[model samples]
Target: MSIVRNIGAEYQPGKGTAFTVWAPKATQVELSLKSNPQTRVPLQREAFGYWTGLSEEAVPGTRYMYHLDGERDRPDPASRFQPEGVHGPSAVVDHTSFGWTDATWQGLPLDQLIIYELHVGTFSAAGTFEGVIEHLPELQDLGITAIEIMPIAQFPGSRNWGYDGVFPFAAQNSYGGPEGLKKLVNACHGHGISVVLDVVYNHMGPEGNYLNEYGHYFTHRYNTPWGDALNFDDAHCDHVRNFFIQNTLTWLRDFHIDALRLDAVHAIYDTGAKHFLQELREHVGQLEEQEGRPFLLIAESDQSDVRLINPINKGGYGLHAQWFDDYHHVIHTLVTGEMEGYFEDYGKPDQLQKALEHTFVYNGLYSEHRKKTLGTDATANPARQFVVCAQNHDQVGNRMLGERLTELVPFEMLKTVAGMILLSPYVPMLFMGEEYGEQNPFLYFVSHTDTDLVEAVRKGRKEEFAYFAAKGEAPDPQSEETFERSKLRRSYTSDPQQQKLREFYKALIQLRKTHPALAHPDKPHLRVKLDSEKLVLHLTHTGQEPHLYCLFNISNQPQKTQLHAAAGPWKPLLHSADTAWGGPGADIPEMLQQRATVSLPPASVLILELFA
Candidate 1:
């Protein structure tokens, strides 16, 4: 295994851009400037298959391509910016050029974020980084604190889900590349908003992945469909680990990203004494200490392991937060009746009650599908887990047809999920187009040079189970139409339901910001009452001028329910079934509001306030 002497070349910012690409077996490596052959410089690589060079003219916004031994032209896997798309030249950016005013902006703690996940391609019709920025005002009005962007790394062609990224360090040129992304981030921060970058470290894309030429970055001990596993625990693991860690910090330091949502951590597969997640957390903590800026790491794992989000001092990874699927499955099953695979395990309101109250319903209980007890509960730890209605890239792209929750659930149900997510103490997330209910679907896409793989993807989509396994007759992921369709329809911003939904979301977010009782979950204050088909969440805070309460009706029929509240001065704050949301429910107090008796319409949720 060849040692990586210059892993720093991929991320360290500067005027003289120095890049170190691992192409060990190749006889020669040349950095070719786009449309210019005279500037092609030969790389200086040692015995370890690592080729490196420092360029004085490779300034920010400059474009270039990589030529291997006078071979065919190829895009740089580490290209910083691509203004002309994936096939375009690499750009050199001065990470310090952009002035950021978030001096006191300690980013949204993962615990407090009402995350709105969006795909730049699908979030707007323009399908570019700059296009997505146009909707920041709308998102701000929609009551979102952070925008968790899907991967922006360069891939083979125009369209992709970003999971097929080959360029670990570069942004897609077609989407206006690095500068475009920086502009969007700057804009988000200007609006007092934070950004979270979704990074994939599990495996490289099938195409444009020439890293094998450098050294043993992958091990054959375990093989995934994506190919070799990253050598996280074996020999030459230090440099490989640094390669990822540096990329992780670069998003924070250069892009001003508040947090990183680590994708598919279970596939990260680090079997070492000091796990990569722990080390990464330590590095981020150190950076946070030096910069005096609050940053968070949100891990995506299905192991139901507490160590992923546990405190670092407790011999755990100490990540700030993690994605909770238990909450998603419960809510998805209840609303959509999608009990095919794993949803079969969570169709009951009782499941949602446990998820809403205790964080996880399957607390070491027997899972009928897994045929074993899943895992232990989060132990009443609500702050460490983020639950939400939808997140960009995952739910949208996971479907066989790339359908969003908006397509399956009614507008009223959308409000219901939004209320349930926002009112809960846990961090909430929303997918792009969810605020206004976009009609487009978020389909799985990719741009691979190999025609065989493209055909395989089309065939794969025709079959359904998980995302990659959807085997539907699909469009060519590399096609221009596919990429174009991913862009969000900005017109939804003006729709009536869109406006109404936006206000409701904003109200909930504002409520969360103003209320302390909604910040974190404690045992006594939070409790959920539910039947087989209906649920009512009752919450009360300690020590205040009043208390917090939210009543939810998950059934398909209007139901009259009773609650355990003193009901001295009770008033309805908001309802999902109001006429604004196209409901016929009346505002006239039911039973004089003395004992808090009210009629909840089908698939509706109500948030109430008690003034003591």
Candidate 2:
């Protein structure tokens, strides 16, 4: 943690700003204030490639850059705000200047998190952090405890999915800078909504990348899908690791971020005694102990490893939770009946049941997709350790057409799928506009300044989906229209059909909060039974206070099953086939008798409260 000391520009109001940079390779480093070559402030070169200097001329709002070896100038790698974009000089931002009102806002527990993931560029009409503030009340009303915002780091251009961000510490200039982010976080805390930021630590973007000139930031020993992995275990990697650790602290301490969703943890290749992930977790734990507030770390890991969410005492990385893709794959294939690519292992009723009973369907089992046995036992993990979603940015945007669940499946089936996710024991996350059934496609859009890189991205998009016969031509990634097309239409919720879907989602979320069986995170209490031939799923809950019986007809045809229960009658809590949810009508009785035959309509979900 001491490695972060004297790094980046620290500005004071009455005093001046102190500039420090880690240019270990450079013989000499100079500070250029206001991007003016005339005012070159000489920095005292210290040991370990660090240079420090104090300048009265450099103040808050002043744009500056580091002149390495008295030659080429590069933006500060630890810049707090990049007001002029990623390629331009970094601005000196005083984080203490923001009058935040969330001093007493202790974050919610991981189990209570109903995460709503939204992109700052596409969530609101203004497409800024301030624009997202206006919609806080709606999310608060929707039972969302945490708002997991997509990456807002400084990217090459205005429009991007944010994966191409190079400046990890700075906020995107087009979507408002550091001050804008603070304002949004303060506003969210005021609305009782905790903020979770998505951060990419695996690799930096190709364009506007200047870390290589400073130190050995990347390692060629291992490569990621995006680029070369960060050098976490290599030589002189102490400061390199501290660079990201300080970034996390800046969000948690300065910006009052409640949690971090680590982007693609599987890509962060590190083979060391103490992994970078574990170090990050320990640092966060120390902060939590000092602040007496719960700060969580969530990982987006595709490896299906339980060690990510396991406790440190249990020999694991100790992250709070991870994104569970198996839940999505099973539900997607079961509802839509699409068995392509990774969806091949899923489509069966037994698979869905397995996913329900256990967190991972392929826990130590052979995966047909990977052509090898994938995952380990995660049955011991609590449900809250997993964040499940039917539709997300990767699932929807990675497609050739970028079609959402609304565009892929029928309206009734969409409600059924929503019921499954919200009622599940695991934490639920709703992608932007998923609650209202917004029809806009979340296309992958980028605005790179480099012509060759832009053309390469366009070419790669087509080549990646060339084998899929069902998918048509993909939208041009270089086009501005593609970015605009992904923006959410808030007015869509006003439509009758869309409003009905939103109400259904709201009801399920509310029931999840109220019902013990739905809210409980214990897996042993939940029992899942599947009829593969009829595509019927019966989930019985007996562990908690409120016993529940959930039945779903995943097929497109009606199915009947005989109910065998102990004694008394069961009350109807929610029926997906009810007229209120834009369904045909109720198929099950209001109060069921023992050994009574119950019928379930096509693409319907029924949740009953046991009163025995």
lDDT of each: 0.72, 0.86
lDDT of 1 by residue, 288-401 (tens): 887788788888877777788777787789887788888888878878888876678888777776776677677788889888887666855654365555445665676666
lDDT value for model 1? 0.72
TM-score of each: 0.89, 0.97
Clash-forming residue pairs, model 2: 24-49
Worst 10 residues of 2 by lDDT: 1-10
lDDT of 2 by residue, 1-612 (tens): 335454789987788898888788888788888746688898998877888999888878999998888779899999988888878899998876789787788999887889999999899989999999989999988888889999999999899989899999998999989889999999999999989999999889999999999888988888678777898888778788888998898889889999999999998887888889999998988888988898999999889999988888889999999999999998898778799988998877777887888789889889888899999888888888899999999999998888999998888888888878887888999999998888899999999999999999999998988887466778999899999999998755569878877888889889888787766656888877788898887777776756888787878888898665564477878898888877888755679875677888888898878875
**Considering every candidate listed, which one attains the maximal TM-score?**
2
Tell me the lDDT of model 2 at 56.
86
